[model samples]
Target chain A: MPFFEAVRLALAQIRVQKLKSFFTLLGVMIGVMFLIAVVSIVQGMGNYVEDAFAGKFLGVNTFNVRRFPDFNMGDVTEAEWRAWQRRPLVTVEDAMAIRDALPAGTRWAIEDARWLAAQSPYVASGPQALVQAVTPEYFAIKNLVVTQGRAFNEQEDRLGAPVVVIGTEVAEHFFPALDPIGKELRIGGLPFRVIGVLEKQGTVFGVPLDRQVLGPFHSALHRFTGARRGLYGVVVQAPSAEAMPEVQATVRELMRRRHKLRPAQDDDFVLESSESALTTWASIKRYLVLAGIFLPAIGLVVGAMVIMNIMLVAVAERTREIGIRKSLGARRRDIMAQFLVEASTLSTFGAAIGIGLGIGLSKLVAAVSPLPASVATWSIGVAVLLGAGVGIVAGIYPAGRASRLDPVVALRAD
Target chain B: MTADAHELAGLSTTGERQAVIGATGAAPGKDWVIVTRGIRRDYDMGGEVVHALRGVDLAVRRNEYVAIMGPSGSGKSTLMNIIGCLDTPTAGEYWLNGVLVSAMKDDELARVRNREIGFVFQTFNLLPRATALHNVELPLVYAGVPAAERKRRAIEALERVQLADRMDHRPNELSGGQRQRVAIARALINNPAILLADEPTGNLDSQTSEEIMRVFEGLANSGQTVIMVTHEPDIAAHARRVVVLRDGRISSDERRDAFVSKLAATI
Candidate 1:
């Protein structure tokens, strides 16, 4: 028989038994639905990290030199932690040497930061804010804009000035309803004049970015932050994206020489770039993708089994029809093709519905929560192929049985 | 072209048929539509062998309308299956249109059946869900005819049985006589070498049976070879020749007039 004839026959069968067909397709539908939804969410998170989270945490084209990795994804063993602890701290001298030896047009800064409570006469106590002692160039590297008062210059940093820049949220907490500029905000039992109020910065993944205070690296805030003993990071910004790798390499070599490391020894410090953070996210995304595939696999398996069972029942019910076709000169291959086509059509239809539902679910998730979602075109293609694949695998046994039936016997069946 | 009464004057004699049937291991001539030489079929029912056909020799020429009649278990159905290419004899030589079909495999037999035989059953065995036109187009479908050609030919076949107006009706929607006519149209759609009917009127009333018999008579008169299997003597009398089976063997083979006389005498 012709291929279209077989497909038509199968479609007619499905139309005649709508309820049964729907039930048979349910498993594949749910399986593919979850598959599409999970993949969309994961894909959305990937876009979010690249566009927002990475830039919010690490400036563009900037890499931080740190004593240890700050954004580790998986668990760190006790031995690994102790080893990281034994590594030499990134001190002010090391930051100064890197700033002096780096190529021209590179922006450099030393950041010594810690979370400390603050107090003001207006409010007895305020929230613990991220207090940092940083060089003047740190403002340019971090893209911080002062909306109110002026930022301190190189002279104030060299003079160990008591002036400080406060974030909008910090201003609201310590000097509520009053002008924060020139007010005294006491930190670690020392009063510091608020020189400026920074522009409002939003949150990233539910963590606030506006609860911060910045002071000169040579000021009295260094005593509270322990900047004399060690620094949190030596941040460097390349002139262009193309110059970043060379700058990092030069800084690595200079740091190696300063630490007196041998040629065979690995670098004890870490170069933390936005790309490095994304690499960690990539590993985590891989596991999410596996889980996405695995969960849907169970649904597809159950769907396949249901389809197989339904096909078997259809074969049994149509024994007399098979005999009639055989008597009309249909070969075994014709019979096989008919059943296989029917099974695949049914499954592919289910998968299409799943794709729609999954996309809808992801959209709903994006609307109701902070997560962002965009449908991956490749996932829709995979879902379609998987639906057809499940049907073919399930149809094989039943189609084979139908094709091999003895016509003489089948013709006699009810 | 159909042979007139004068051309079919003395049909093949018993000796000539015997000579053709005795030519074992040799293909039959093109003039013979079906020839069986000692064709035997057996059924092993839980290791107990029951012989359905035991060394039956028969020869049928082109454009002949023949009937095989017997009581239940007389092996008439078995011979019909073998002649229809639906089943192969366990041991013996069988030829249809110059081909030794008894030695053919399942797929080969299917092709042969598609090209050389059309079947009408007692139950009218029309596909219940398909329209009359689609049912008639089935044999042509398996024969690999294109869709437009199949539809044209199916409509033409339905017109021959005066069922063109009823072509869109399913089997259940049509009357008994109409359904049988649809079955007849389907059987003849591919223009096979032989039209084989098994108890073609067993499920119909006497009036309906006569109605179906007229249709078959018309087909046979048009130069078509037809073989009908039945247990009714009256039904067998409609054919030009009758072969009666008893205990897996041919009890009598005679002309229609002779068969009617014998049946009348026995009654």
Candidate 2:
């Protein structure tokens, strides 16, 4: 018989036994659904992280020099940790020295930022806000745009002027009814004029990007309790992305010389670029993908088993039909192929439903939550292939058993 | 006995009278549709051997309408199975259309069955799920007929059986006689060298059985060799020649008139 005829026969059988087919394929459907949905969400998160690292948190041409690597805390070796601990802390002095040593046209900023316990400016309630003490160049280095009044000038930062730039959220909270740029807001029981309000930068990795205040480094050092310890980090921007490697090399050399480190000794600070961040994220995404595929693969195995069991039953039930086919001159291979096609048809059907449901589920999640998700085309392909593969593998035993049946005995079966 | 019965009986005993039987490798010619010499079949019933057929010799010629008749456990069904290529004989040579089929393997037998023989069953055995046209198309499908040609041939076969108007109806929708005609159409669609029927009208009423017998008569008259296996004396009487089996051996071979007269005498 033609292969398509066998497939059409399988489809007719499936149609005749709709409820049984649905129940048999349910496990595969749910398995594929889970796989596609999780993969889509994970891929979406990866895309969002890439965008945030390149545009919002760390601009494409910018790099950060810190006392320790920011994102790879768990990956640090014991010896590396000890070596970094022996190094001097990155301070405002080192930030200044590195800035001066860099090539012309390069921009740099030093800032210390941390979440601090505080009371709301408008209410008696306590709220936590990110407070940053930064130099005048911080705004340019971080690519933050002032939407309201002008940013504090070099004179204000040099003279330790008592002025602040607030984020959109802060501006909305403290001066909802008035212009926030000229208003006064108290931080840590000290009053400072809001010299500027930043344009809104949305969330990144679920963290609100526009929910903080910035103040001149000198004023913050004098007024904030923990600001006197040291600079948290230094941000540097090359002329363009092409010059970033040279800028990094110059900064490293300048910092090492300032700290009096010999040629053989490791530098105390870590220079993190967007590339390193993305590489780390990629590694994490790899694990996420494995975990996503692994759990759902268990479901697929169970689904395959279900299909195999049901197919065995079907073969047994159609023993006489098989006998009739054999008597009509159907070879064992033809019978086997028929049953195998039937099994794959069931699995592929389940997979198609799974794809639809998975996309719907991901869309639902995106709508209800801040988590972003988009279906990956490759994931859909994998889902379909996996479903069909499971079907073929599961059908082998049952199809073989059916094909090996003795026609005389099968024809006699009631 | 009548002159025809005497002649058939003489023909059945020719090899034995001439001492030419049991020639293992002797091949029959194309004039002979089926020839079995000392064919035997045994079943292993959990170590106890049950002999189904003990050296039964049978010969059928081209275009001959022959009926094999026996009671239950007389080995006639087993003989029918061997003739249809559904089972191989245990220890003898069986040839169909000049081919030594008893020595053939399972898949080879299937191909031979597809190209050389057609089978009609007691229950009509139409696939309950398929329409009459699809049922008739089945044999051609196994023969690897192209789809268009297969449909055309199947339609022609159904039309020959006078089932063209009912081609779209399923087995359940057709009457018992109509179902048997569809089965006959399926059996003939492959244009096999012989038509093998196993109690073809066993499930139908007498009127329907007669209706099916008339169809068989037409087929045999059209030069198609027809082999029908039945226990009914009247059913066997419809064939041109009748071979009666008793205790796994041929007890008598006679023409239709002689067999019917003997049946009437016994009643």
Candidate 3:
């Protein structure tokens, strides 16, 4: 038969038996919808996570020198710490030396850490804002914004000035409905001036950045913290991604040289890059995408079963017609083509409906909630093709049966 | 253009007149339109072997009309099935239009049936929802005749069956006789070598049966070889030859000459 004629005949059958075709296509629709929806949500979440990390950290080729690893299985051995401890850890002199060593190439060399005498039950504003304490270079590193005032300066830190900068949330929490930039508060029973309020940066890993406070390194160091010799963490910045490894190596060597470590001793602090943050984010993204692919594939298998059953029914119903066509000089290939077309058309139509619904749902979620979502072109195309391919593969058995049917017996059937 | 039956006699009027007289089945292979020898068909009905045809031998010449008559269990339908090549005999050779149908595969047999044998079932077997024109056009459609030619040939066939005016009427909209005429039109559409009808008039009234028989008589007189199966002797009487089956075998064969002497006086 001609190609157009075969398609016309298949369409006629589907039109005549609309209910059967609808139900058959429904299976494929649900399957493809599951795939599109899962992929969209997971992709949105991955992008959101990236944005959150970028907002909270001053991470332009920045690396953190911290004490421990988040995913560490066990504590560092005493011997390991003792070996590391002998290497002089970061100090003010060491920070100044790194800055001097880099010359014109390096951007910022900042060091900071908080020493909490007690948790303070996480103090709040009258309307319940959140708070934390950070230092001067924290502004340049994470690209912090001062919604109102300015960050502390070298003059303030040199005199151990008691000026502090509060996060947007901290200002809202402790000094609601009032200007908080020039306010005063007592932490560890020492008075401090609130110089600048940080811009509103949302949560990262459920920890709100804007819900924190900031202060000069020396102000917190010599007075409230009362730390004669304790170090928190160090954050360093490089010119660009191309110079990150060189900068990290140079800084490590500079810290080691300044501390005057022995030949056999190791460095004391953990040096981590922004890649670690991205690595964690990437694993989560990969897992989400994997989940997205797997669920749809499972749904496709179920839809395939439904298509198989429906095609079997179609072959049974049209046995005499098949025989009639066969008797009129149609080949086995023609029989196969007719049935496969019928099945695949059913699935392709279903997939179109599913993709439409998935896109609409994504849009609805974006509109009604805080979730970020965008559907891609390839997702729609792939979903439709996958549905059609499944239908064709699933229809093979029934098409084969129809093609192999004994024409004599089929014509004899009432 | 307005030639009488005398001019259009003998299969084709001009092309092959000297050809068919040369040699035929009993002599060679040219005379016979169908040839069967020691044909046997056995059916396996749930492990029990049942013989539907037993060592049957027959030949049908071009331009001959034969009706097979027997009771229900006598296997006349089975015989017609074999003659139409919708089936194959288990134990003998059968040829239609000089092709050994029994040796051919299923798809090949169907092609032969499409090209040579036109089958008319007792129920008429019109696709219920299709119009008479489309139903008539089906065989030619399957034959891959282009659309315009198919429409023309189908219209000619419908005109031949006197259903030209009812071309667009579906089977359900037509009477029983009209429906049978459409089926006959479909069968004859391809202008095959033989028209096989299994009780063509079985579902019709006596008056309708006579009317259908007149159409069959006209078809045979036009040099289209026609074979029919009927239990009614009155139906069989219309044929120039009658083959009687009994207990899965041909019990008797009666010629038109013998039957003419027996029944012309009553007519």
Candidate 4:
């Protein structure tokens, strides 16, 4: 018998028994679907983390130099902490020195102070609002938009102006009236002038940036919060995306020298990118993708076991055909090849449908839920290979049985 | 080589005891297609030994039309099964074309059976799902003949069986005699050396049986070896020779013409 005719016969048998074939493929379909779905969600979360980092850290050349490497992470001895406290705490002097010491490609640099634990006055007419204090250069680095009023200039900082930039919420809360940018309002019992209204900066964790009040560093420290603390950190902006890595390296070298680090000593400050936030997002999904790759393989192994058993039954049912083929000059290898092809087709078809459905379902999840996802191409390839491999391995025993059947006994079978 | 030598030795030992009756006078000078010696077939029926064939020696020349007659359990089917290579005897030697087939392997025997024999069963065992044309084509297909030649040969075989017009009809849609003819067509498609029939007319009515017997007689007269197993004396009388078995042993052998002359023509 020709192999082509044999294949057609097998396919016809499957078509004649649609319900059995459907159930057989269903097991593989479900396993592949879970695999692709988990891969898509992990991919989506990775993208989201990267975007969130872009939001939090705008300047590509930006690097933070502080006593501790990362925020609240590295250890500093009590003696070092006392000495650090006594040293000028990131003053404008330190900023000027570092600004002059940077390389030729270096661009704008500025510093601002922040009280780590300062509570914002939450005033709400419709929704809650928060206030943050930043230097005038904060607008330049972040390039924040002012919807309605003017931001105070260098004169305000020179004279320690008590004016503040009110956000959208501030206007909506105390004064629904128009042009309230010039109005006076006491925050924490301190009279402050509203100089400008900041626009929205999108939302994160259900809180919008337009709800925060922006102010000069001195006004936040001396007037509103009533504390005379130095600037917290400095931020720098590069000219272009191409110059980011160079500027970052220069800043690190300069910070290392300024902090007086020896050759072997580790820097007390951390230089990071939006990549860390993305990694934080990636870490949670790493386990999920890992589990997705292997967990469903356990299901696949179970499904393969069922496939092996089912194929065994199929071979037994078709023993006479096996024998007949053998008698018709079919080699043992030929019988094995035919059954292997059948098993592989079953698994590959199942994989294709499952991956297709899984990709669609992941997209649906991203649209309707917070679970963001995007299917990766490599994941699909892995799924196909896995399904085919499982089928081939599962088919071996049954194919052996079919190939080894004696033509005489098989023909004599009742 | 050692196993082959041992097989040859075993094959000679598988033949029954020496038959003194035809020991020297059996001048089988012409080519004999089949030669059996001391063929004994023992079957275990639920631990009770049933001796189906007991030292039955037989010889069939080319183009011989012979019928073996016996009651149930007289080893008629067993003898046919062994002769047709559908089975191997417990202790016996069957020489088809002078090859000791009793000790051949399964695959080797398959090649021999395909090349040497055709079988027509009384039940007309055409596949129920296949058309008459496809049923006729089955044996040729198994022989690995090319598709074009195979199709042509199958059509020719069906034409010989006078089933060309009903070639597209499945076995279920065909009459009993037509179905039997289709089966015979399938059997002839391979052009084997011998055509073996087991009660070929048992499932047909008297008229249809006679019709089938006419076909058989034509085949034998046309120089094709035809062997049949039947219990009816009249059916056996149609053959040129009749061999009888009783209690697993051959009771008598007779030339049909001489036997008919000696007995009454009641059949």
Candidate 5:
């Protein structure tokens, strides 16, 4: 029979049994919907990490030295955590020693970071911000641009000057009507005059990039409550991208010598580059993507099984119809083609609905939450093809059975 | 075609029919629509062999309206199946429209069935969900006719059965006689060489049965070969000739007038 005629017949059958068709297609719809929604969200997160964390926050050719090896605390074992705790703190003296040992063009900065709210006696309730006590070169090492006034001078940093640089959010909240460069703000009960206001930076992973206050490292260590506990890190910047590896090796060697560690012992300090961080994130993202694909694949398998069962039932129900078609000169291939078309029609319909629903869900998530989400065009294509593949795989046995039916026996079937 | 009726009448004896029909692979002339020589069909029911047809020899010429009648176990249905190209005989030669179809493969038989035979079943056998017009277009669809041509021929066939006004109605919406007329139109859509009707009016009332018989009469009168299978003597009387089967073999073959008189005398 003609291809169009078979399609027409299959459509008519679906229409005649509307409820059954809907239930049969629902499995594929839900499976595809879950697949698309999760994949889209994961893809959006990957973009978010790439843009906000890898590109903007961590500058090129820059690396950090910390007491702990990994960024997140929960990822390390108990013994590893104890070992890291036993290691000596990364002090400002160590930072200076590393800088002196590096190439002349390289720069380094030390910071004692803490979450502390800044308040102004001029305003009723001031914004809470992450406070970083750092040396003057920290701005240059971290690639932070000051939009107003100027960064603290070396003399002021050395004398533990009571000068501060406020981020864009702190400036906007504490001194909205006045130029914030010369304003005085109290951070953790210590009063400091703002010498500069940094340019606006966007959020990263839900943390506001602009909500921070920078103070002279010496001044903060003397005034802040937790500064004496020795929680501090060093940021180093190579003169160029090509010098990064050598600079890192020199810094590691210099730190090991300064600490007087034995040659057989592992280095107590952790050195992390922006490239290394991004590589770790990429590997994690790969696992997320695999999980996103694999979990929904279970749903697709179940949907395919449902399709196979329904197709088998349909074949049995249409035995006499098959016989009639055979008698009217439909070959086995024709019968097989007809059933296969019907199965694919069922699945493709589900896929279309699934694509729409998945996109709708992603849009809803974007609207309702802080997490980013986007539907990749390629993911949509893969999802639709997967649905069709399920249909073809599920249709094979039943269509083959229909094709192999004995026409004489089928015609005699009641 | 009518001039060959005398030669067909002369080959009446069983041995004479075999000699005329020849053995397997012999070429049949154009005037012969169907010829079966020593055709046998066997069925294996769980290792027990039951012979359905026992060396039956039959010949049907073009434009002949013949009915094969028998009791339930007489194997008349088996003979009809072979004649319609729906089945191949177990052992023997069967020819239809000058082709040796018994030796043909399944797909070859399908093509032969499409090109040379049209079937009307007792149940009307129209696709229940399709409109009368689409049902009538089915055979032409299998024959690979183009859409416009198929539509035109289907409409023309429906008009021939005087169902033009009801072309869009489904089988369930039409009366028994209308449904049968639609089936008949479908059977004739491809203009096949033979119109094979199996108990065509078995499910209809007597009035509807006569209406269906009249349609067959019109088709046979217009030089179409028709082979009908039925157990009803009255229905068999509608044909120009009757061939009765008993115990998987032909028991009697006679003109319609002679069979009717015999039926009347027996009653």
Candidate 6:
């Protein structure tokens, strides 16, 4: 028989037994649903980390030079911690050497930060906020724009001015219903004049980014944060993406020479770019995506077995029908094609439902939670092919058995 | 049989049938629709060879309406299956439409059955889920007829059986007589060289049986060759010629009047 005719016949059979057909395809449907949902979530996390997390925590075309690695994913053992503590801190001379040796277009800043309780006259007691001491170029490199007042200039750093730039959350809490610029905010019994209110920076991974205060690295804020012992770190910005590796290489060489490290020893300090910062997350995401596929693959296997079982039953029930068709000039391949089409049609239908449900589930997850989801077109394509392939595999034995039946015996079946 | 009976009813004489059956390795003439020379079928019943058909010779001509009547285990069913191309004879030559078909393989026989034989079963073996139109269109579907033409031809065949108005109804919804007519329509859809029926009226009431008989009579009058297998003397009497099988061999071959008189005498 023609291919379309067999498919039509199979569809009619399924329609005649709607409830059975639904049960038959349930496994495939659920499998596909989870497949789509998990992949979507993993893909969403990947996008968010690449687009938002990196941009917020690490500036564009920027790398950080620190005494030890920041954003380490794994736990640091006791031995590793002692070794890191024994290394010399990033000092003012090292910062100046990196600044002078680097090309003119490169921007650099040294910053120190600590979370400290703050007090303002309007609010006698307030939340502990991140207080940072940074050079004047820090604002430009970090893209921190002041919506209200002006940022501190180069003269403030040279003169050791105590002017401060406060983030939106700090502004809201310390000076509620009042302009925060030109106000006094005291930290550790030292008062600093607020010169600017920085623009809002949204949270990353549920940690608020706007609860901050910035002052000149020359001010007393460094004493509170222990930067007086040694500077926290220097932030460097390359002019372009291509210049970042060269700049990092030059800094590594410069830092090693200053620290007097031998050729056999590792560098005492760490240089971290956004790419390096994301390496741990990339590996984690790969495992998540594989787990997403593996779990759903189990569901698909179960679904395939269900379909095979159902097809075998259908062949048995339709033996007489097979006989009738054989009597009407149907070849063995005709009967084989009929049952195969039925099995695949049933399976593919399950997969399509799965795709729809998977997308809905991902969308629901995105809506109710912070996770953002976008459906992968390639995943949908894979799901559809998988559904069809499962059906074809499941249909083989039953279809073969149906085709090999003797017409005389089959016609006599009840 | 005499020349007058051959001229009046288009029946082949015993001498003519013998001549066609004796041509062992050769194809029959164009006039012969079915010719079997010593066709035999055997069954292995747990290490015992039970012979179902013991060298039965039969010949049928085009446009001849004949009935083969016998009791249970008389090998009439075996003869019907061989003539219908549903089963090949285990021994001896069988020819249909001037072709030697006894040695043909499974798929080849399926093709021959598709093009040359149509079957009407006793139980009206229609696909219960399909509508009358779809049921009639089945043979043509396997014949690879395109959808539009298949539908058109199915409608025409249903119209021939006067069941076109009921084409959308399923087998369960149709009356016994109507279902049989639908089976008839399905059988004739391919315009096969021979219409083979197995107890075609067994499931119907007497009135419905008569209604089915009239349809078969009309088909035979239109020059369609038909072979009916039955054990009922009255049903066998409807055919132009009747052949009786006793102990796997032909006991009598006579015209319808002779068969009716013999049946009446026995009664």
Output the number of the TM-score-best candidate: 2
Give the total clashing residue pairs for model 1: 0
- Between candidates 2 and 3, the one scoring higher on TM-score is 2
* Interface quality of candidate 6 as DockQ: 0.72
Provide the overall lDDT of each model, using Cα atoms, as 2-decimal numbers. Answer: 0.90, 0.84, 0.74, 0.70, 0.84, 0.89
lDDT rank order: 1, 6, 2, 5, 3, 4
What are the per-residue Cα lDDT tens digits for candidate 4 across A1-414? 455655565566568878887677777888888888888887776665556445544444455544433332224578866655554345555566667766665554344422222122334224434555555766766667788887766667656787777667667666765576677755555667888888766554344556666666556434333323544466666666677677767777877777787989765555554444445556666677788877667768876877788789878887766654554344567678878877766777678888998899899988876546889999899899978888899899999888888655665554
Docking level of model 5: medium
What is the TM-score (0 to 1) of candidate 2? 0.94
lDDT of 3 at B157: 92
C-alpha TM-score for every candidate = 0.89, 0.94, 0.80, 0.71, 0.91, 0.93
* Per-residue lDDT of candidate 4, residues B49-139 (tens digit): 8888988888776777888999998888888878877678888677776667877776576677667778787777665656888877766
Better of 4 and 5 by lDDT: 5
Query: Which is better, 1 or 4, measured by lDDT?
Result: 1
Worst 10 residues of 4 chain A by lDDT: A113-122
In the range A1-414, model 5's lDDT, one tens digit per residue, is: 666666676677778888988788888888888788888888777776676576565666888887765445135678887888898887657777776787888887776777777778677576568888887888887788999988887888889999988888888889978888777898767679999989898677667879878878878533473655654677788899999999999988888887899999998887887777777777777888888888768878888999999999999999998998889888888889888888877887788889899999888887776557899898899888988888889999999999888888889887
Screening candidate 6 with a backbone cut-off below 3 angstroms (N, C-alpha, C), the clashing residue pairs are: none
RMSD list, candidates in order? 3.5, 2.8, 5.7, 8.3, 3.1, 2.6
For residues A225-272, could you state the per-residue lDDT of candidate 1 as single tens digits? 987667899999999899999999999999899889999999999999
In the range A76-195, model 6's lDDT, one tens digit per residue, is 788999999998999878888999889879999988888998888898787788888899999988888899899999999878898899989999998999998889999888888999
Off by over 4 Å in 6: A8-16, A74-88, A122-128, A228-232, B45-48, B246-251
Instruction: Write model 2 residue lDDT over B72-187, tens digit each, in one string.
Output: 99999999999989999888888899899999988898898888888999977778999999999998888888889988999999999898999999999999999999998999
Give the DockQ (C-alpha) for candidate 2. 0.75
lDDT of 2 at A289: 89
